[model samples]
Target: MQIHRGLLQQASDKGLISAQQVQPLWDFLRECEREQAHERPGFRATHILYYLGGMIAIGAMSLFMNLGWERFGGWGLFAIALAYGVLGLALTEYLLSRRQLRIPAGITACLVVVLTPLLVYGLQLGLGWWADKGHLSYRDYHTRVDWRWLLMELATLASGAVLLWRYRLPFLVMPVAVTLWYMSMDLTPFVFQDQDQSWALRKLVSLWFGLLIVLLAFWVDVRSSRRDEQRDYAFWLYLFGVMAFWCGLSLQQSDSELSKFFYLCINLALIAVGAMLSRRVFAVFGGLGTAFYLGHLAHEVFRDSLLFPLVLTLIGLGLVGLGIVWQRHEARISARLRGWLPEAVRELVERRG
Candidate 1:
């Protein structure tokens, strides 16, 4: 779909366009491409650096926190977090309004969202409302699963929503997605109530909660597409949702070969859905799950069968062939799949940025 100046020059030489119009048309196209690049999410060098810097800062404040920070105490930590949030909001506003920078503005807005859990945790600690055992450190918010973290997750979700609404930044959805993932774990304890926590309960909760988030992500995707927004606000939601869902799905221990085959079928369906929707996240997870199932067959189910290796080798080659075939007719295949969708959903998926 790319049109270079050389192509335009060729078009001029072929009399498709006048020589005089070539440069002007090329200039217009370049400007349009530049504007589109700025408006949409891209993995270009500058965008990568923007997100990289933002992630490092966010990680430093959250995941990489040291015990030394606890010396500040609950109220002190609350004050510090408040100051950071205020400064981040100010910078976000400046980046958006004054400098017309959406990427950096989104990053700063997300940073503010990242601080919400800390803010609430600090307030809870200060008020002596934190009751979960061994939940003394704010850093435990990321590591431990406890019902006590539910309030922090709720606060984070609320603040993230408010910030996302106010700023209309796609990146602001990241913290919201992450908070939902965290809440999926914390809510397990609450659901079980006084009973000892079990992996079965956690996995089931994660599976169901992840499905809910994925549905939410789909809704957001449709809404954003309908609005003709240039940004992908549902990217993070889909990513975290798939991670949660796939992790839970993969962790289930099944001894029956039929159950394993069913797992493989589900993964195949995921791959199909991914191809239909043009979402690589689903494809990635689905591919991994498929590989896991295959590995299980090789190591356990067919260990004594020498033919299994040859069969797997043929399957791999067949998949490669399938990929080549898919690549050759991708446009036609995509169109056919899209044709089966409801008109409204088809429009949203087709118009995805």
Candidate 2:
């Protein structure tokens, strides 16, 4: 309130706004306060439900594993309980909608929190079963595949995809699902037997899914820009994740000269894309790429004298400095363009610019 008052006073003093403007601004602030108040209960309730739900699910699973069928029902009971919980949530949402009451944010939060752990547990059980059999190495199969593990992975991925699609948060789920699918293939020993085929499949899947995410993100950016809501930082983060996925795939094959070249080129491309999107994301992508480049250079120079490391350090610093200078140049150009016109004119210019 104090900050807002100060701002209003300054604006009034500068003749940028009239004293009458203060009342409207205050009303806006009050509306915002009301919305926050309305959201608070839902937020708190959702978090509490999340914790309680997770505990119940875990406890039930543990009991079933310990005393199957007699004292505890078994894994089937856990699945049934989860399904019931989901159905209950749906029913509650329907009731609330019919009553014209606001749908609580906590409900969504609770569902996400509860489901996350259950999904992980299912993944572990499936992986464990596979490992116990001859299909995978390691008794627990943390990094190896089992049939049960594949089923869990598929279920989790499908559920997440459905949730994302339902919520219209495709950017959030696309990278995650892509990553899970990639990791599943990596852990599956059957794929490694035919290394080239496996590698090609992974690359193809990643590229195909990555392009989808990229196109979706671009569409979002366009729509948000049109709606004058282009400040969404999540969109930029999603783009970075997409770029990271491609870069990660390249790194996995770094033993090959072609892969090493691809990694460097892709990192550069990511840096360019980030620079175009937003400064914060650009800096993040640049920092990551720089780190990888330095790591690779250091490895190559490890056997050489101190001169090699020093030279690489100098080159890396130069690249970072160059990026900073380029960013400053772009900022100056943007500022000049924006400042050259009045408010209405600026909006018109922005549309074209």
Candidate 3:
């Protein structure tokens, strides 16, 4: 314990960390070790074996079905199955390797290498399908509901959800789940057989779900904060899910005024929530909300008028001026407020500056 204390002191002296932050850093280190133990190769191997056995059992069952053995002899089907097995094994191994399970890094790479192209291809296919069906307008595409397509979509979403659960990959799962929900919207009309009712119901459900996710995320953040720990990036997953849910809600409402109002309310709520969380990113989001409000007012004044450019230019200048003034006056603001603030608050402000 003395040696540990000395090492911590040395670390603090080197500016590797502050004395106050050492406790949380030590706790995080212990947590990582615990997680690493769970992700050992032996445990991973057992998990892989179990999944492989299940896959084989399913494949064998499929082979016994009415679809003749000859049909399964095709190279494409065989290759696909082989690839699936190989990829599953690779993914399992990667997850089980303690040092390799860098959640943020892994997810960012996966999004770039996998999700981005997948989404692009899916969008192209969806567009082509719509075009072939003579649905030129976006609204027309929503009206045309195909049950078979919707079932396929649901199946795809289920498969993704299962994969996420099995691998315990929250980062990948969150985005995939959100994309699944978005794709699910295309199926809404088929379920209700009317765009208006279907979309309205979808929006209401989405709003509820969004609020739930956001609140859950905040709870998670607060829990972590209380422990003086870093929050997981998966918290952003909850945010994305909430955002996607709201996007669906926005699409459902055709009334431009109502949509704008709803969007403003949501942004304002985000700002409030972010402030409470003491998140810099969320504070930036709040700033964005303010900007959006300003833009909306400007839009109303300049709508279909020659004053549009002038209004935009004035807004831009005003924002730049405010930024400069803030930067210049920041020290004065800090000094003046320091005497009235608590010690903790003063320290926080000074550190931020």
Highest lDDT scorer? 1
Q: Using TM-score as the measure, which candidate wins?
A: 1
Cα lDDT, model 2, residue 170: 25
Error of model 3, residue 72, in angstroms: 12
* TM-score between candidate 3 and the true structure: 0.45
Candidate achieving higher lDDT, 1 or 3: 1
Question: Candidate 2, residue 1: CA error in Å?
Answer: 19
Global Cα lDDT for candidate 1: 0.86
lDDT of 2 by residue, 42-144 (tens): 3566546744664464344332223232222224434644775576457445634564223332234234423443444543544453244443322232343
- Indicate the worst ten consecutive residues by lDDT in candidate 3: 112-121
Residue clash pairs of candidate 1: none
TM-score of each: 0.90, 0.53, 0.45
List model 3 lDDT by residue over 1-353, tens digit each: 22355677689999988999878777777788667654332346654664455445433423232324224333433344445445544655564574465443233323322223223223444445434534222222223344434433454455555555454444444545454454556556665575564556777756656566666565554444444333243355456655655555445544476667667786777665454345555445545656665577667744677777787789789979987997899778657867786665455444434
Off by over 4 Å in 3: 1-82, 98-100, 104-166, 195-209, 212-233, 245-265, 278-286, 301-353
Distance (Å) between predicted and true CA of 269, model 3? 2.1
